[model samples]
Target: MALGGNPIFNGKSFRGATQAPRVPSYPQSQPGYGQPQYGQQQYGQPQYGEPAWSTQQMSSDQLQQMYKMYNRPSAGPAETGRMTFDDVIVKTAACLAVLLIGAAISLFVAPGTSSLLMVVGALGGFVLAMVNTFKKQPSPALILGYAGLEGLFLGGLTRFLDALYPGVGLQAVIGTLAVFGVTLALFKSGKVRATPKAMRFFMIAMLGYLVFAVINMVMVWTGVVNSPFGLGTSVHIFGIPLGVFIGLLAIGLAAFSLVMDFTSIEQGVLQGAPERYSWTAAFGLTVTLVWLYVEIIRLLAILRGDD
Candidate 1:
């Protein structure tokens, strides 16, 4: 739930580098002396109106060196420079790979479905998620650590649920992928957007969801509700388990969270943010997708319970 409807996106502003001073623009033709455009001037060129004797020229090597020094790619990719799509993709892949490995370990090594490991993973993942989220600068190690911890939690939880529901984990995985693919396609096509108004609504709804989640968790912990899912399964709306609706709401929130992530990454790239911030982009996407998967699996579990 940490990534669910986040008020603060890992998409924070990075001020390490600013766009180069637009490679000083020089007029191609001045009113009096027609000095060629900034880089257009060659080794030996006199102003259009200048006398031949007045011409002062430099060597071709000098001109080329000056041009390169002045106009070469000012943005450094390896040096906290502008981010690219490749940076984001590669970083995200690394995080997901770590997550998968962690999941495999938990799934294969856990003894008779241990909730202890799940709890540990959940707690550790939560802590790391908070750390990485709030940090001003993105930390690759911390983000990857969060991924692994989250994966452990996921693997344990999936095993537990699948044991009861049988094949539900696979179903949930498919569902999560479907939602993600659909959301991404819609975003790339510009069919759906996170507008200002939508964002306002999102904030309000997210606040309400957080309140509900906190209350439910408290109810469960305090034993005010005996049900495993607390209020989510205990309460009903329109003869349907309240959790069904709540899970759907959570899924919607997660989907929008993705939209926000995508929008932020788009802005970051367009604004020429540092490539190092790709870790930031990767982190945001991982958070949202994990939330999405959790919601999907939980919803499926709720449905199976109802049946």
Candidate 2:
């Protein structure tokens, strides 16, 4: 989303959409512009065979007409490397396909093997994510590769969690879809937006959330809190688990992130961003969806943890 430091949309020159040079108007070569029009009489056309033309005899209107004759038609958006809604949809589908393939592979593996896959997928996905994110030009292979790796991670993690919290995976899937649908509707209706003020607030909240996440991780690792879910489990507010509040907040943040993703994609399409960057748009949306799904599932799991 347009939240504080989303590097994907914030990078220079490599961002989703960029300003393109105006289409050019091609003029005749005018090879001998300075000299009298080649092969023409000193005064003007000879009024005989091969009626010659000279630069001196040329009028502004005539020059303009001649130039217009050579001028080329403007390039269409596809030719200009501009983004389109179709490009986003197509590329997103490809990424999702690859993701599902990876996830399928992880799903049926032995429990022991699934655990190993989870670790490998998580680490490998993180590495690939960074590589794809910072590249100046969009790479279909890398973007799809990231999707596949993340699918492995998601599948393994989901399998592990689902074992403990039965039906959480399905619930999360429904929740993710519901949120996506509602958010898209709101965005299309112009009810929800990534306005400057809203984005500022998003960024601040995201930063605070990141800080808390890091501290909580440290606390768990250092045995400061023995809860499996870190401080989210140890702390309670108003008789509910902190994670419920945090998870709800996180879900809200992720929901807004989808808006940012939509904004970026819409901007790219409207700006006629390079067609290749459609992959970028697709990747951005996938990341947001995955984040949203994970948050939703985790929240559900946490709510059912004590049960």
Question: Which 10 consecutive residues of model 2 have the lowest summed lDDT?
Answer: 1-10
Q: What is the C-alpha lDDT of each candidate?
A: 0.82, 0.83
Count of clashing pairs, candidate 1: 0
Candidate 2, 45: how far from true, in Å? 7.7
Q: For residues 206-301, write the lDDT of model 2, one tens digit per residue.
A: 999999999999999999999988988888888799989999999999999888888887766665567777888888888888889989998999
Error of 2 at 83 (Å): 1.1
- Candidate 2 residue pairs that clash: 81-274, 82-272, 82-273, 83-272, 83-273
Q: Model 1: what TM-score?
A: 0.79
Among these predictions, the greatest TM-score belongs to: 2
